[model samples]
Structure formats: C-alpha cells, structure tokens
Target: MPKHSRHSAKKRRDPRRKTMDQITAENDSMTLKRSLTATQLLLMGVGTTVGAGVYVMTGTAAAEYAGPAVLLSFLIAAASCLFTAFCYGELASTFPVAGSSYSYAYIAMGERTAWNISWLMLLEYGISCTAVAAGLSGYLNSLLGIFHIHLPQWLTHTSLQPVPGSEGTALTAGWRLDLIGFLSVILVTALLARGVEESARFNSLIVALKIGVLFLFLIIGVGYITPANWVPFIPPAQANFHFGVAGIFRAASIIFFAYGGFEAVSTASSEARNPTRDIPIGIIGSLLICTVIYVAVAAVLLGIVPYAKLDVADPLAVATQIMGKPWLALLVNGGATIGLASVLLGLMYGQSRILLTTGRDGLIPSVFSEIHPRYRTPARGTFIMGGIIALMTATLPIDIISDLVSLGTALAFAMVCFTVIWQRNYAPETKRPFRVPLGGIRIRGFWIGVTPLLGIIFCLVMILPLLFNMVHALLGGNPVPVLLLVGYFLIGVLTYRFYGFHNSLMAPSRPHEQGTSSHPE
Candidate 1:
C-alpha cells in the first residue's frame, strides 16, 4: 500500500486517540463553571450512594437471597467498588474531563470504544435516575400516608408492571402513572438547569438530613436486636441466587447499584475547584463512608426485624413499624423520599454532562453540547434527558431493568480500570496526581497493575451472577432482559454508523474543527 494510503487508514482506524495535552486543552475550554469544592463533591457522592439500595434493595436482598448475611453482601459490594474507585481517582486526576469514563476511554483506547462506554453510561445513569425517582415516589406515598393524605392508586403506581416471576417477559397494564416520580424528575431538572452549584447545595443538605435519620435509626434500633433472628446467618440454598454462599454474591450484584454514586463524582471533575486533589478525595472518601453506613444500617435493620418479612418497598419503615415506632417510620420514609431525590439530582446531572461531552465529540447532536450562557449548565440537554427518564418512570416497570443497570455500571467500571492500565503502559510520562495503590508486574510486553487487575477481576465477579441469571431467565421463557440489552447495543451501533461516524470532530477530514456551537435555548 502507498504510504499516504496507509496514513489515511491509520487515521480512520484511530481518529479519536486524544493525547493528554488535547484533553487538558479541552478541559481548559469547557464552559461548565468550576464552583464545586471537595466537600460538596463528597456530599454529592454520599447523597447519590446512600439512596434506593440502602432504603429498598437491602430488604429484598436479605429476604430473598442473603438473609442475615446481607451485611456481608454489602461488604463484598463495597470491596469491588473500592478498587474501581482507586482507578477512577487516578484517571480523573490524569484527565479531568466531564465525560468521566468515556473521556478516559477516548484518550486510552479510541473513539469507538469511548462511544460504547458513553452508551453504557447512559444506560447506567438514565435507568438509575429513573429507578431512584420511582423509589422516591413509593417513599413519598408512604410519607403522605403518615399524614393520612393518600393518593389514588392510579396516581401512585406505574402504568406498566412486570409480572411476578416473569423476568420482564410479561407485563401487566393499568390506568396508572407515578405522578410523584414524574414530578420529582421535573423538579430536579429545574434545579440542575439553575446550575451545578445550586444542585450540589441541595444535594449536600439532603445528604446531611438523611445521614442524621440513618444514625438515629441505628442509635434507637440497636437496643432491640433479637439475636435469635441471626441464627443460621447464611441461609441454606433454596435455588439459584436464593439463600446460600451463591446468594451472598447474588445479593452483592443487586446492591452494587448503591455504590454507583462515586462514579458520578468523577463526572464532575471538570467542575471541581481542584480536580487533582479533590476528585480523589471525593471518590474514595464517599465510598468508604457510605460502606460503613450501609453495613451498620443492614445490621440494625435485620436485628430489629426478621429478614423474611423485609421485602417491602419501604424496608426501613417496615422495621420501624415492627418496633412499633410509627414516628420513626415516618422519619425514615421522609428521609428516603428526600434522599432519593438527591440521587436523581446527581444521576441526572451526570447523564446530562455525559451527553454534553458526547455531543461535543459529534457522536450525537451538537445541541446537547450547548451550554446555557446565563446558568452555565447543560440546561437544554438536562431537560431532554430528564423528560425521557420521567416518562419512563411514570409509565414503565423498572424491576426487570434493575439488574441491567448493575451490569452496565460494572462494565463502565471495568473500562475505567482498564484505562488506567492502558495509560500507565502507553503514556507513562504523563503526570498523575493520584495513582492506584499497589505497584504492578509486567508480563511479556504488557504491564498489569495489581489495583486495576483486581478491579477488573472483581467487576467480572460481580457481573458473572447477573449474566447467569439473565441466561437462566432466558432459558425459562423470559427473554426480555437479554433482548433489551441486545437491542440497545444494536441501536448504539446504528447510531454510530449513521450519525456519529460521519459528523465526528476527530474525523480524518475534519482534524481542525472546533466544536463551538451556539448556546442552548
């Protein structure tokens, strides 16, 4: 082949292999304001981390899978998250960009990989935001019940629900919509449109309030521990993912959704006042804090009530009711309602930012990249993504999609870990303000660091059970989850081929194009 032809082919193959300098230049040019401090970032992580899973997943995981061993499940999930958190810290410091893992992937791997990671992140944050909103609606309804102000069932429930044991293959329809969930998304969207600083402030306040309520529950509920309830702590296996050692890992996968908040913090790297110092602090600090709180809450919750009876939407409220503390139950419900809203804020914020970055790259419409001149936020993109999530929350059943969220999160985390290893080997001279602890050994031509390797392994461990369950469901006549995943990937591929491939800023023919679109309306 001719040398010029070879050069053109190389450019076509890897057009978006951004160097560290390019990434830094892009960060310097970002319109997003850098008003967030380390403290607010940490609180935002906590606010997003300590929501639906702690308030809801714990009970169902305990009742159906881990039983009293659910506390151990929390530990396992935290451990898996810890290694990825370290990798995120390193990558965030190395490339403090708004796209988070997507940015890291573009710099390390290429644009195609980055686009897929961004797509998976969309699946992660989009569904997660909707799920959190749906959870908030349930808690909100419970809180209103305390005041004897009941909403009509049609207003409180979703219009579509997955059939019990259908694994998402069967759905039941009704004249219903979660108005509270829909409105909550709109409210959070408005706050995010106002600006990142205002949204972080609201999240910090909610985090503080929810932590206080949880600590109160711990203080009062500890004295009521019925030690007998913990007998046979690891329940015997009844079926796949049902009460055994397998169940413990299964429960870990289910609750992994709660640990996703730390990832959201990395998305704010471009907005952090001190990305090098503060991003790591926010990522690692929030994970450690939320883990301890999760374990403590799980212990107290199981102690106060039998795990068998804790599968309801409002598990903490159930425990409080069992303790005959209607007031505490009200408080817990109120805290959950408020806390899940913070999750919505952080997730929606992260999702919109990801869209902004992708749009700037020309993988999607440039309109999403438009920043509001006054608010300095992705207001237009925020409304578009929020509307989709709100519509989904109001209409669709989320139960079957919950595991899919965990799967997407694990994949994105694994890519982040791999990016650290890739950058370490390919761009060793790049200055890193934060490094994943534990030096690595090189095998053959590749250097594999212990932290990132373990991160990948742990993510795979978290993913295996979920995959097994998906296969199990498929074989048992429930193919919705697997089909949905495949369909989503196909959509991503078609999008890249039809739109992203032609319009990409990094295309060989458009090497010098700067993405300076007009401001969003």
Candidate 2:
C-alpha cells in the first residue's frame, strides 16, 4: 500500500476520530424532540402494530388452522408476546436505546451476537415494509376502483407468482403486477425523509381514524352477526391434518406478526424524557390496548360471516365488500391505506436506527452511522432501507414477502428471549428495572435457572407449530418456495461473514458488554 493510502486507512481506523455518542450529540445536530408523551408513544405503537395482519391475516389464519378457534390462536400469540414483552421491558428500561433488541443484545452478548440480531432485525423491518407497502397499494386500488380509476399495468406486474388459488382465471384477469403498491412505498419513504415528528403526528391521526372505523365496524357488523356462522368453530382441515392444540399454536405464530410494532416504542427511548418509565408504559400499554381491539374485531368478523367464506388471499376490502355495504368497504380501505403508512414509517425508523447502531459499532461501513447534519437522524441508512423496500413492494407478491417478515421476526423474538435468560446467568450485576420474579432465589442452583428456563421453553414451544406448518406448506406445495426463504438467510449469513464479522466492534470489548455506548461507560 502507498504511504498516503496507508495513512488514509489508519485515519479511517482511528478510534478517536469520533464515537457513536459524539455522532449522536445534540449540538449542531437535529435532536429528536422528546415530545412524545406516554399517550403519543402508545398511539405510535398502536399505529405501527395494528395493520394488515389483523384485518387480513385473521381470516387467513382462521381458514388455514384453528377455524373460529382462531380466537384462541390470538390469545396464545398475545400470551407469548406478553412474556417477550416482559423481556423487552426489562431491557428497554435498563438501556433505553434506539436499536431495541439488537442494541440490547449488543450490550449484553457481544459483537457477533449484536450483528446477528441486527441482521435478523433487518429482515424483520425492511422486508415487512415491503409487505406492508404492497398491502397499502391493494387497499388504495380498491378505493380508487370505486371512482373508476385504474392503475397502469406496468406497475402492477412484477417477477412474482400469485398464490395458487389467488390468481383469477385467465379470462377476467387484467394484469398481475401492482403499480400502486410501488407508489405507496415511495410515498412512505418521502414521508419518512421529512422528519420523525411529522411522521408521528401523521401516524397519530391515522391511528385515530382506523380505530374509529374499527369501532364502527364492531357496532354495525356485530349486529349482523348470526349464530349460524359461529358453529363448527373448529372445522376439520383437509387431508386429516387437523391440528387441535397444534392449530392454535400455528395461529399464534402468524398473529405474532400482528404484534410486531410493539418494539418501535423502544426506538424512541434515546429521545424520550424519562425513557426508563415511558418505554415500558409505551410497550405494555400498546399491547393491552391493541389486544382488546384485535379480539373485538375477530369476534365481529367471525360472527358476521362464515369462516369458510372469508377470503384468505384477498385484502380486508373484500371482506367488507362481502358485507353488502360498498361504502363501508371504501371506509375500511381508506383506513387501511392510512393505517399502513404509519406501519411503514415506524418500521423504517426502526430499520435506520439498527443500521446506524451497526455502523457505529464498526460492523458495516462507518458511513451508515452518519447522522444527518440537519435532520439529526440516520438519513443515509434510512434512504437506503426505504429505497430497497420500495423496489421490493413494487415487484414482489404479498404473501411471499409476508412469510419472510414472519419468519425473521419469529427468529429474532426467539433469540431475544434466549438473550434475557443468558443475561440472568452470566451478568448478575446488570441493572434491570423490571425483573420476572422467580421465587426462592436462593434455593438449589436449578431454582435460580427456572425463570430463564421457562422463558426459553416458552419461545421454543411458540416457534414449533409454525415451523412445522411452514415446512409442510413449503414441501406440500413447492420446494422452490422453501429454497427462496433459505436463500434470504444464506445471504444474511454471508453478509455477516464477509462484512459484519471482520468489521465488528466487539473485538475490543468484553463479550458480555459488547454493544454498550462507550460514552456511558
């Protein structure tokens, strides 16, 4: 290497050049205003958390497994979430950082763990944005169809296959690609680029609108509910593949995606005024509120129509259309369009922060850690993430994308629970504001391991049913589909090995405290 080139490399590697904390300093930087009260944060969580998953996935889950026993599926999912939420609450209260579990893992487990968590989160947030963007486009097209406005064909068609039963027959189908979905993704990226407060306020308004529409649905739709629809609540599955307990567990796995945005609350922790108190309130409060709404919506949906008649492949607009009220369908579609925008923004914010954290730790390129000179946000990383999602939404089929989102999130949650258990065993000194009580603290060594023991078991049990179903769904249908998913994880592993592993910030820090902010220490 030339002398100047060597000097440049030395400069790039200089630890004193700037720290992540320095990059995040309030001076001459756009500080994220600590304007979100617990109420706003809760609303933000709801805004991001409740979207296509409940409005669309409920029917699909009901059709595939659990039948009307789908209600139990949700309960099962929420219970698992409550346990994970306990884990998240403990971590968020202690660190109160932007990267959520990825950050928490970094501080507790070391660089390698942090890199994997961030890699998994990248899948969870970015690809999920693509899925949500596609969802928003579907709703928008339904709304526009009422006005006799149609989207162009070029935008709608992409290199993806429609789910087997979902492809309308050869004669009537106009086009396969979705242009509006791509546009919606771009629009959301634009909104995110503008700023966080704007995004939050926009989300708050949409949350109010969607919740109101849902309540109206409950009031009006619930009245039309007939007892006939509720019978055969646990219908038999095809091929004698009847999953009683297993079906509920599978439902729990799917519904888990519906509850994903609860972690978005933690992304704002660094900017929160009293992060320790507010972070937990934001997470727990949002879950409680959304869970109630989900149950109400499920009850009304199943009651109003037979589970067999529900369109698992179609979006929620069709469900309302079947209600024989086109205007209500319009309202539902509009609410969904607005509702999913908030989901995109919250998710985009999360993706950027994780990228920023990864860069700060030298796991990728340091440029990713760069905060916008004026916006004080991870502007570069945000743009890169949003652009990739926009392209994905423009091209990919919805369920294909959704599966990746669900798979990634499930893996991440499973790991998070494991990390919490690992912490209790190895790092007895770490501060935890809220701890899951395992009574008889001084009993035999086995007693000390019980809380973590149960937590790990809980995660594994929750994961098993879905793993079986997805594998079956993949094999029973096409092995190609399963290979594609494998491809995604393989890419993640390769990326980590060549880029993330060599560049990781963990080499200098103790594994147990790898990702903590150097400033705090």
Candidate 3:
C-alpha cells in the first residue's frame, strides 16, 4: 500500500476516531475461505431465487391478468431478468467483493453512487426478508392444518380478502400477528450470524430440499391435471383492458423479486475459490436454472387448476386441496417453509454485507464495519440488519413490502450496469478478471463499454411499468411497485445528503489524525 501522509495515516488507523479509511482497512482482516464450488454457489442462488413467488404468484397472476396467459407473464419477466443477469455476470467477475453491487458502484461510479446503491439495498434486503417471512407463515399454517390443527384467525391473517368466487361480498382473514413468520426470521438470523460458511452450507441444503419438493410437485400435480382445465388457455377479454394491462405489469414487477438473489452470489465473490470464473458462472447459471424451474412450475400449476380459480395466497396448496390429496398440501407447505428460509438468509446476508461496506466507506457509522475477530464476519452489521428485517415483517403489509423490494433491486441493478460503462471510460487501467468487450472507440474519441449500456436500457424498460404503478398507488391512483422505490430513493437522497455526504470518504479532510485502528484479525 502507498504510504499515507501523517494526517491520512492517523485517519486510516484510528478505529475510535471514526474515519472511513480506518474502517476500510479494518476490513482487510477478512480472509478468503474458498469453500463453495460453482455447483454449491449455483444451488445457493437457486435456493433463494425460487421461493414463494413461483408457488403462489402463478395463481395470483392467473386470477387477475392473462388467466392462461400467466405463463406469458412469466416469459416476459424472465426475459427482463436474463438481461440483468448478463450485467451481473460481468460485474461479479470483475469486483469479487463482499458488498455486491455497492462495491462495484464504488470502484466504477464513485462514492456517491456507491452510497445510493447501498441505501437502496437496505430496502431490497429488508423487505425481501419480510415478504418471505410472511410467505413462511402461510406455509406453516397450511402444514399445521394438515395435522388437524387450525389456528385462530388472529394468528394467521394480515388482512381480509373477499371470499373467492362468491357474490356475497363477505370477507375473511386468518389472523393478526403471524407467529410462524416472526419465528422464522429470528431463526434464520441466528443461523446467519453464526458464520458465512455455515450459512452457505445451510442454504445449499435448503436448495436441495426445494428442488426435490418441486420435482415431487411436478410428478404429483401432473397426474391431477384434467383436460377440461385447458379449455380456454387465454381467458376471453372483458371490456376493461386497463386492469388487464395493469395487472400484467404489476405481476411482472412481483415476479421480478423471484430473480434478485443472483446478486447474492456476487456478494460472496471474495470467498469464491476463483471469483472471476465462479462469480459469473454462479450468477448466470443460477438464473438459468431458476428461470426454467419457475416457468415449468407455473405451467404445471395452471395445468392442475383452472387459471381463473388459481389466484390464492398459497396457490399450490389450494390446488392440492382441490385434488383431494390433503397430505400433499402439507408436504408442499413443508417444502415451501424450508424454501423461503434460504431466501431470507441469502438476502439478509447480501444486505448486511452492503451495509458493512458503506460503513467502512464512512458513508454510515463506523460501528457497522466492526467484524468479529474469530468469525471474520461483520457481526454488528448482521445483527442490526436482522433486527430491521424482523421489525419490518412484524409491521408492514406484504404487498407493499414486495413492491418495494422489486423497485430497490431494479434500481441497484441499473446502477451496476451504468457503473460498468463508467469504469471502462475512467478506470481503463484498473485490473479486472473479466471485461465487457468494447464495441468501438469513444464517441468523442473515448472508449465505451457497450454491454453495460445495453443492460441499462433493458433494465430501464422493464422498470417503467413498475415505476408507473408505484407512483399511481402513492398518489391514490393505479399504483404499481416502482412507486415504492421512488419513495425510498427520495429518502436515500435525504439520508445521503445529510449524513453520508458529510461523513463521506470523498470529503476533503478527516477530523482525527492520531492513530490507526487495528484490522480485525
């Protein structure tokens, strides 16, 4: 490392003094483990990425939007995800850092963009965890019901929905506080805080269980499909295309959540045996595996039940009930409960790492950068993130949380794509294990990275409807998910301007210059 001036050295070394440099260097103690193979990493990605969305959302989408055309919605969403994954594959290969998109943004775009990306990640990680927690509660209830144990509504329901297909307009809800959801979050947090290696291993096991359960669903559900259910593949259009289009776009955003944990693969780049090769493979390969699974599961789902009747919170279980195989519902629910645990663990792990990075950058409090010496993990950040996620799940509505997650995730991906382009122009000499091919010399005689540019455009297009819907909802209009993102981004700006900017590493000088903070090891 280059020798710093006396002032810079003091700032870099003193943990108590609270400069960004000190925090950054403190993280130098984190050693690489290289335990995960490409297969395990891919399985980790798939475990988190293929959760409640495919199992439940298929029915939800079929009921509201294209009916039989819900499969098309899955296709549209998959196309959008594929574009983003290419960008992720390239960046993960290059950075190989624990902070995922935030670290990439820092090196490529500068500190401000890094701050913003980290800020958005707070929501992406938190809300996604809470949403899965909610799903877990549903599955838990279903599992219990199989044993003839029906809990009171106050324990299971968040809000009431009108009785399905009933003209009576009567409404019912399960319960007020979901105990199973709350407990699952706490359990996953405990497992994650233990260590990265343990968490990855646990996630891998969960992924395997999910795959097995899905295969079971495919075999059993196939036998239950009636030829009559296939009559009108596309439900005949009603007079209102407004809800049709709106619902399709909304479902698209919802499904977007199913695609996000691939970035979590990048967050573990530092620990990969060969990050340059494994990170890209993990990101892209995981996405491909999950995408195929998602589409197949959605198809098999619609095949088992008429599309119109499929839109329950737990669609797969509902279908099993219709098949008069109550035991299968319990088994599927058990699988779903386990499946969502991996999602929460993966997402929370990714989010906390981002916060740890930002804290080290002096964009947040220095406390967040503190790693446990023995574990070499950011224990403080992990626990804090767990608390936030738990509180969020205990309070927020699942729909709002789901939408916010999609928006934040998309925003982070967009910045990463932009960062890739910016880095080629400004940091061409920087060493990278992977590089996006330059298509041409600079427009103004400067070299440009076209891959990131294309990635940005694709993400932007996919995010448009999400944005519109979110705004519409916020203004009491036809709201969609992207609006929640805008709201959170605004908060991020305020937070950065007031706190992160003032304390930022890019600032001209440090307040204390007397000592160096020791690295964690």
lDDT: which candidate is best? 1
Residues 413-484, candidate 2, lDDT per residue (tens digit)?
777777676565444566778775553243333124344445556666666655665677665664544666
The TM-scores, one per candidate, come to 0.95, 0.85, 0.84
lDDT of each residue in 345-423, candidate 1, tens digit only: 8899889989999998889998888889899887898889889999999998888888989999999999889889878
Instruction: Please say which candidate is ahead in lDDT: 1 or 2.
Output: 1
Clashes of 2: 6
Ranking by TM-score: 1, 2, 3
| Candidate 2: 10-residue stretch with minimal lDDT | 166-175
Q: Report residue 260 deviation for candidate 1 (angstroms).
A: 0.7
Clashes of 3: 20
Local distance difference test scores for all models: 0.89, 0.70, 0.71
Lowest summed lDDT across 10 adjacent residues in model 1 is found at 512-521
